[model samples]
Target: MPAPERIPSRGLTDTELLTLLAEGRLTVLGQVRGASNAVLHCTVAYEGEERTCVYKPVAGEQPLWDFPDGTLAQREVAAYEVSEATGWGLVPPTVLRDGPYGQGMCQLWIETPGGGTEPSLLALVESEEPGEGWKAVGFAEVGEGRTALLVHADDPRLRRLAVLDAVINNGDRKGGHLLPAPGGRLYGIDHGVTFNADDKLRTLLWGWAGEPLTSEAVEALGLLAAELAPGAALATRLAELITRAEVEALRGRVAGLRTAGRHPEPSGAWPAIPWPPV
Candidate 1:
């Protein structure tokens, strides 16, 4: 697990993502709530319908974000690209970019047929199943919608996210980040804090701790473990964003669990789960 070079955002640039959208369609969509640095909700004008999006200023007063100014946005862009390329199904496609401030990431917004997130996912998690109640609770959208991603245990998709979260060492993956759109489609958002290699997998999605793994989940983990080997080739963005130790840990975690033949346990310690699950 060699450390990847410091190539922020894999190789995709912010403006470049913006240019990916049709030209001469710059328009302000909306305003997002929150004051962490420069978080805001924005919409980018696109073909046919106006795609919803998020806006985060690059010139922020935060350190260690790689891009203290505008790096997170760029990294997010790169991450989305990688996920789309690898068919990881973790993130949405980058529809367009407004120089990092806002991005038109056009994955199906996970809206119900005609409304915000559907609640079926939540209901399923609340059922009598494994890992049904160990999730952190809070809602915060990087976008403008007041709707939050409804995440619950029992959903194989949730487990898949855990595998990805573990591999990326996502320091934050509250329930809110897992939005359930109108359809069965689930979207994972706020990947800005992802791609680290430390044991920073802090999240509230483990409510149903120690539940048995689904057969499909086991297979997914098996595939992930295979991809996280020592000499594994990765997308440029992930190589630089994740650490060697993290990759090793990811490899070991995925491999060990699959080999041992069990569902993931709520291991390690954290500060009583984050205040908000977002």
Candidate 2:
């Protein structure tokens, strides 16, 4: 069979990109290096429009003792749905579909506009005190075994993401997962280990720990709470992706966070952070 024609990446709108994700002819571009299962970067083509996306096939996922097998891809899509429903726009456009590698979650790759590369929020420092706009997280070893101070940005969007993570019970919120896009926008990825029935919100965004959530952030939580109304569209969509108990856990987290009105301190219930913090 002849191959599908390609389209301009910059030309497609958000809605159009989603349509292409669902119906586009996916062609594997390459494998993305990571610790977990196979992650493919591909070109999604449809109706003369094409775009780059990340595909995480269920068959490629490494089995986890805690989370059920073959449901990581669904969780990826669920995270995106939550982001959309809450109007957070923290997660990129993701959809669950059958790809070249079988059933998987395919998400449109977010390109830095104007070809500008944004740095990860975790910045490395060598023996220098963290200046303004940055807060030290911990220490790290650099080249020649030099010790370096690792820090994260004090941006509000990150705080917003921190709140979102609490709501989803994100099990793994790595520094590398936080992508800084053009125009100062931040996008998060690698959400296959989320929405567990148990509390597993491991993250390195402790800069805002124990701090009061901003009014805007609190309002967003309220919006998410309302979206989970029994028979609401968001609730129905999530039910199709995650377990009923997981959905209920999401509701519980939202209510708990809203009641607290402050960024939570580590409960010491589980590991407070993920390994390889960056």
Query: Whose TM-score is greatest here?
Result: 2
Report the lDDT of model 1 for residue 125: 29
lDDT tens digits, residues 1-278, model 2?
A: 11112223477766887899999999998998865799999999999887789998998988899997338999999999998776778888899999888999999887765443246467887757766888766676787978988778888778878888888888888877877665567788889899998989898777788888888888888889999988999999999999999999899999988999998878889988788675
Candidate 1 lDDT tens digits, 1-278: 11112212234344443443434244445544554556545445534434444555555425674323335555455455444432346665543344444443332233334443335444322323234343533343535654453345455567666655654556677656766643255667666665554445676565434666656556566565555555655433345544555445556666666776654554556442455643
Best by lDDT: 2
lDDT of each: 0.49, 0.82
TM-score of 1: 0.62
Alpha-carbon deviation at 39 in model 1, angstroms: 3.0
Pairs clashing in candidate 2? none
